[model samples]
Target: MEGISRTYPGRMHIAAMHPSTQEKSWMTALQHLKRKGAIMALAFLSTTTLVSAAEVTYERLLNPEPGNWLTNNRTYDGNRYSPLDEINRDTVKGLKVAFTVPLAPPSVGAGSFSSSLQGTPLVEDGIMYMSDGWGRVYRIDMTKGDRGFINWIMDPQTDPEFATGILNNRGVALYGNNIYSLSPDGAFIATDKETGEVKFRVETQQNPAEYFSMAPLAINGKIIIGPAGGDGPMRGRLEARDPETGDLIWTFYTVPGEGEAGHETWENNAWETGGSATWVTGSFNVARNELVWGIGQPYPAYSPKERPGDNLYSNSTVALDADTGKLKWHFQYTPNDSWDFDEVGSQQLYNAKVNGEDQLLLGHFGRNGFFYNLDGTNGAYVNGEQYVDRVTWTKGLDPKTGKPVEYTPNGGVQTYLPETRLDASVFTTEGADKSYCPFIEGGVNMFPTTYSPRTKLVYGLAIQGCAFNQAAIPEDEYLTGSVSAVDTATGKVAKRLDLTSAPKGGAFSTAGGLVFGTSANGDLYALDDETLERVWTFNVGTMIDAPPMTFQINGKQYIAVAVGPGGVGMNFEKYPARAKDENAKSMANFQQASTLYVFSL
Candidate 1:
């Protein structure tokens, strides 16, 4: 027995010596293998565990289905045009309030300026996702509720760095299975689109002082996010990351580095902190393979002496290669910017006839109060005209060079009267004017513009107002400016709706023969595309700044506005409201309800 055990183990081992037993054993093994195979199949179907995931491509990021708003400007042109015509001009009149999502700040306990719902929101497949300035995101089911219910909310207060309660997250970007939100501290976090669970957080910048205010623009499988500390020492930059793995792909600095073309434009290499940021969302030109963004003013904004020459990328609209952050071309709207007039609003891309030839055009109503038309392909100047009446710096812009000619303001430039520190309020425009609509403080900040495809016209709300007795501060403190829109074809004042003396929001246009915008007084109105006449108006009872978005759901059309107050225009001490709400706390604390109100017929 010992010998047998040594040779073949025990009786079970001997049983295998028989052919029938061996066959039985093989059958048992086959049965076990089948069970294992079944288990493997179940696992494959039950879990999404595959490491290889689909990348968020640029094409996918910018273009969503008919009803989906994929990026900030709806389409890359910053046109905010929706193909859905369910809410045409004829039907929009019948539009009634469909639902209102009261996006209250995450906590009243938190000390934050009461802001309105600033995200225009992207709605698709019965789901609405948006963010407030406080870095809170709400995913709501559009199909189920007469009033949208919050499916998930991610508040920035959960992040320690974002605890200051001052950061503003405008909105979020959605692609594949993830929803991406940028934090005020420059962290790009990806969350499950269905669950709102954070997948990963990529720090785009290290400075906490540099607030992350831009809505992330997903392009061609890359997540593009820029910084908002245009007021600080940090230079502005945008990063493209692999949406799937959160890996850095490329970075484009608004200010040039050493030994570069725009390097000489900065003082003492202070270009390191120059303020050319993409604060507002950018538009993508699919045909051009370019992502165009406008840079903010140079830092210490008021002074041009610290930063001389036309700061290469500052105060300019640049076209960059989407895949590789290469500058394809740029048009500097204000060179040697002395007034802090930044090119920091919407860069509306449209196709128009230039000199009787078809060309891709970009319309910019810069803070300098001039409307510009540039070649979208090469950033060539087609036309630039002064849309505002009170522009005292230069009488007109050189169409060829896109530079303003100082005929009258030869020595009329607003300068600092000594002893004035960097006081922002003292830096107002002091010039003579006729019907100056949007006041200087009410000038266009980082807002958006609307382009009309049917009229081949871009409808913009120009703030026509002037400033006087602006105390001169250091060059840096003086640069903050306003927003406006100029006609691309004529370089003529098609329309200028000044918001200087009031509460104004961004502009929106549609194919339905209408243009829409808001005021600090909570007045939302529609204008005739042809006449720029106010045709329809509604009082939502909130001051607003962010642009409005329109889309269709369940064969019904809706227009949504992101209502928020208190920024530049909300500086009640300066630009006081037409009538103050006595019931509100203090005028400074007169918070606009942060809510997304949807209207449909």
Candidate 2:
């Protein structure tokens, strides 16, 4: 409000003038206003004029200012580490609720199911931008002293029926003067940042059955989007579009088709409907001009017998040429994945010392219970170790090749570590049950992991415990979560904090020597980055499924996270025995609501 103008003079006269005349008239009017006794007003006008609508440039995204969170991971490298230290361990205890904004209600006629706030809020220049599970975007002004006001809300009017399960919208992207968002029914809409008016809408997916829930990644004037629908029959692909015009530029399919290099991995035309959905936002390597993304699991999630061979791209991380959409290299973590361990989680790119040598590495805390450190330039395997306590899938990864120790090259069907494999008899005409560790819920899900340069450690929220795997039988009976601090130099977990319930949220580390995260039992935690010890905890009386972010407004630092419930966090309710656990019972007692909480000293 300080730097914005109410009206521009000579608007009606300029309407009938030529282009050059209109420009001259506007300049003259501004000069006349400045000549008058309105220095403060003129200063405000100059500041507003200097702030162009197209402020989110590639350089700005690569090197974001201290107070802005331009992308989902806060930067192109996906580190999720804030440089701000005002709210360090020394001052975190002084944190109090700065403000709270309740998100819009879910779509009408939607069932009684709960809503989830899964997206990280993006803050730029004292304005916060976030979206709800129903694809409604909100722009809130955080410059209002201790409290903020919702500047505008843009609802895409997403049809709730189109979404398969509990609705979840990750967040939105900002570029130039438009904010890009995706609907549950596969529509990509661009809205005016000032008025919240729809500028253009394009249908990204033609199939009525396919939809997307993840946020779009803005890079080099292009918008890169990954599709969801991993739970159903869907072939995964990544597409790039012109951010300004919404025109298709190029598309890259994760699962190769016939005549392609990796087509032979699929049998019975399984590649056509392969469920390697790219459901999560990926990281970018500006130096190499490569887009590194993680791919999900193959189709028929639990029944690996239906599809065979080392499913090429699924359960892998692929690096493609950002300009041409061509695959440069890929490293598959799980071949012939039988446990539904999707590798479609965020990848953190950083330079680290590995085995006595400094190398640019791509790190991932995989759902399959392993921490991988790969060559960022070529996707070559460098080092990997089990980051979770119980990894029965394999004895360990082959140090040289980074594959399961028992992996057989070119094998049609894999039975690595047979003891941990799903029971073959369970899927037959006469079904039997088999138990497995690191169940289908995974050692880690889409919740992002953070890397702190100061501590040289990676922090993650990992699910602990094992579960029984049988066809059509629920697998939530045995599960829990943990917060782990892994040393990057030696792929070993230095410390761990176990949770009594499954964790759906991720962690955010800062230079302040602190790590911020939330638990399913409604407790927000601030842990020591080096020791992984809890320094502070606040119970907000609801579940937290999104990552925490920090920003500065008016020179005061603030921390914020969206709190709600009912995503994978609610899976514990299916297990009646979970009621016996205090944490699980406490989380079950609270209902989900789309509310965002911001705290400051």
Candidate 3:
């Protein structure tokens, strides 16, 4: 038989065989071909048999098949819940580390020394796609070995200055044969999935200071993204673009402008500089054809006197016509919020039995410490309750409207629950110290929560703390975080697991009666979804501030999480008591690094 060798472009080439050594080398060459063929067959079978592996379609995104994480939060509804149960509570204890991939820091000039692994990796067709804090996209092939190998890394080369602080990206989006990434410096890039080549780059912002750190949401041929930088002087907005061409389809300003709806809420041109940034990926209602996004705090966070009235769209959830980008309805959670209480957390969509009737509901855990259930169709308030231990900003929410009890309709310069509001005198004098619960970082921040239809419960990480806000002195603070299970119908926290250390990570719930979360102290935890009891724990030897995801390859299940520190981890000194624990202190002491740990049963 004649020995032959062939090479595929951008892939490994078969070794050339010599006629003299054909007997020995030929056999090895055949074996290599067999192995490579098996891998190619597996990839072919996965793409042909698995719905998610075929193509990133709207139908698949709306209802992703089990074992695939299509979007940042797993589904269009932003539930972050997977139906896969191969590695359930019964099997989780036996899970072992399958592999660990240490990622390099973002390029030399990417940013400050601070870099984090914050993205919720998206897995499809045996390929894993993720982004680092500085917007570098990486694609890894999981079908290769027991330990997967990185296929390619696509660095968008975003501005280094924009990569500072807590404004880095949380993830990337996948579409038909292409991956979408929004850079820290406001560039929207579409990269080829197979070769990791940049397809096109579009500037999303005109202001050099404005940027986008959230993952783009791809739906029905439109790529949706929101702006960040509300902490400074920036007007936030959400835009929809053509997925293939990166051309603008439409744009909706989070903070309305003069003569527009909600514009009157800002008194003296505050609307021009309003800071209601949409800092996280939002939930989509496929049936209603609407998209709901959470808006951040107003400009000059911590000082509401700069802008008056209810600050209409700030600290609110707005529903827009998905295709048209027109506002359908909005519900403000905190009017004229001054505690830096941004409502910019993910909105979870679910169908629930409310008031004895099946209703479409939009659920949210506000940074101000309230759990709200609203009518998903029209943005009407259905139910509201406190989901945290301490909430001093308001006595409670208005039972009918779901607004803070102290909120005055069209009110000016709100000082809700005077004692809890930031000392207005801070603008002038320095003596008064105002204390408020659910400290500034919020009851929940950028970390996305999860909802399980199987358990009919919503799981969220709640930060509990009290901050003393004075004029010039640093606000004295004490904080702790907890994992809470809330009932969908009643808007009540059904159970809570308080971590000895603060929690900056989010959670994932599975049909197998398990909820997975990581602690600030590098421990991976699997808790009983019903009882909220700890079932298993594994220390990852570093800080974990990113969410955990579950996926399957070749019928075996795996759990993956990005481990590192530095988003909210830098605030370890603010909660001394919470960090007193050995594990907590250790995590606080660890330096930041970019690493991905995958475990399997």
Please, what are the lDDT tens digits per residue for candidate 3 over residues 1-601? 0011111122222223233575557445644553232111011011211122466888888778787898988988899988888878788789888998887653322333455677799998568999887777777888643776676677655556544435457889988888888767676778777766566666566554476778889999898887787877888899888887787888899888877898889987788888888878888888888888999888877677778888778899999999899999999888888888888887999988887999989999888888899999888999867877888888888898887777778558886788766634333454356667776667887787999888899998877665553343343333567998889998888889987666767888998889998766667899989998899898876667789999988877889998766544654332323453644444445666778899988
lDDT of 1 at 318: 85
Number of the candidate with higher lDDT, 2 or 3: 3
Which ten-residue region of model 3 has the weakest summed lDDT?
Answer: 38-47
Question: How many Å off is the CA of 464 in candidate 3?
Answer: 1.8
Error of 3 at 255 (Å): 0.8
- On lDDT, the candidate that comes out on top is 3
Give a tens-digit lDDT track for model 1, residues 406-452. Answer: 32223222232222212232334532111121244324556667777
TM-score of 1: 0.79
lDDT of 2 by residue, 364-419 (tens): 98898888888999988887677677878788889999998888877477988776
lDDT values, one for every candidate: 0.62, 0.75, 0.76
Alpha-carbon RMSD of each model: 14.2, 9.9, 9.6
Q: Which stretches of candidate 1 lie over 4 Å from their true place?
A: 1-63, 106-116, 158-166, 407-442, 468-487, 495-503, 572-590
Model 3, stretches more than 4 Å misplaced?
A: 1-53, 106-113, 162-167, 423-432, 469-478, 571-580, 583-585
Model 2 clashing-pair count: 0
